[model samples]
Target: MAATEQPISYAQDIKPLFREGDRESMSAAFDLWSYDDVVQNSDAILGKLRDGTMPCDGAWPEEQVDLFQRWVDAGMPA
Candidate 1:
């Protein structure tokens, strides 16, 4: 976990997980555009990420996934 106890910000943390083309490519199926959208669908997001079923290319780095989980566990902080 990160040393700082500050809550994760979607803009700072989660949004970066998606790539430059992600919004265009995954638009039809998924949208990681804003905080509310993510917080509302956090369960599905975590599930897919945990199971290595997201990104459509490969699993995220362990640390990245861990960080995301921390965000979720922290009540999906903004």
Candidate 2:
């Protein structure tokens, strides 16, 4: 049997990436709380991730980053 394919969900996958309290802090510049917010700002998101400018810390683990890229490549689905 073939492996099941799971669609990435914003509420399930993406939203968890951001810290709860900090979500509002970045809202002034970028809103990452919803599907539209991520889709609209995907370029900045991916670019920042690639350049290691996001997370205000450092690069996320390779697996997590890959997951994010996969979500992006999958059209930033909700």
Candidate 3:
């Protein structure tokens, strides 16, 4: 099966997207590595990713952003 054809889960697909630095940088606001935190702020996070304002350093690539959107669309499975 193709990558997009498979189910997306937080542990396997979503959480790994956030690097250590990312977790640290966003720590003051939220825990990027935490499922609850991510799900709670998904919309705002998606907006930032779409607008190229996340990471506080640089924007994620189009594919990464799209993957994130897909996870959200999938009901943010854990």
Candidate 4:
């Protein structure tokens, strides 16, 4: 639940959970996450998910939420 506990690779675990490779619904952590303030705020992104403001297309599953949370809880590893 802490940043230090994050897994090393974002592309490996986190990317796969979302539409990263789908192209149609693909979401790059970098695109959603900017180098500025937003990149560091995982909750902001998750809040969108939790409040049904994400994808702008559809909602992610709870399991996907957990995966995203884990990645966020893990410090949004790059």
Cα lDDT of model 3 by residue, 1-76, tens digit: 2765799999999999999999999999999999999999999999999999987799999999999999999999
- TM-score winner between candidates 2 and 4: 2
Best by lDDT: 3
Runs of candidate 1 with Cα error greater than 4 angstroms are none
Q: Each prediction's TM-score against the native?
A: 0.82, 0.80, 0.93, 0.57
**Candidate 4 local lDDT, residue 45:** 71
TM-score of 3: 0.93
The number of the candidate with the highest TM-score is 3
Residue range 32-69, candidate 1, lDDT tens digits: 88677777778888888889888778888888888899
Model 4 regions more than 4 Å off: 1-8, 17-30, 33-38
Residue-level lDDT of model 2, residues 13-32, one tens digit each, is 87898775546767887777
Better of 1 and 3 by lDDT: 3
Q: For residues 1-78, what per-residue lDDT tens digits would candidate 4 score against the true structure?
A: 344544634666655544543334434443442323334656677897777667677778786777777766666666
Backbone N/Cα/C clashes per model: 1, 0, 0, 0
- Candidate 2, number of clashes: 0
- State candidate 1's TM-score: 0.82
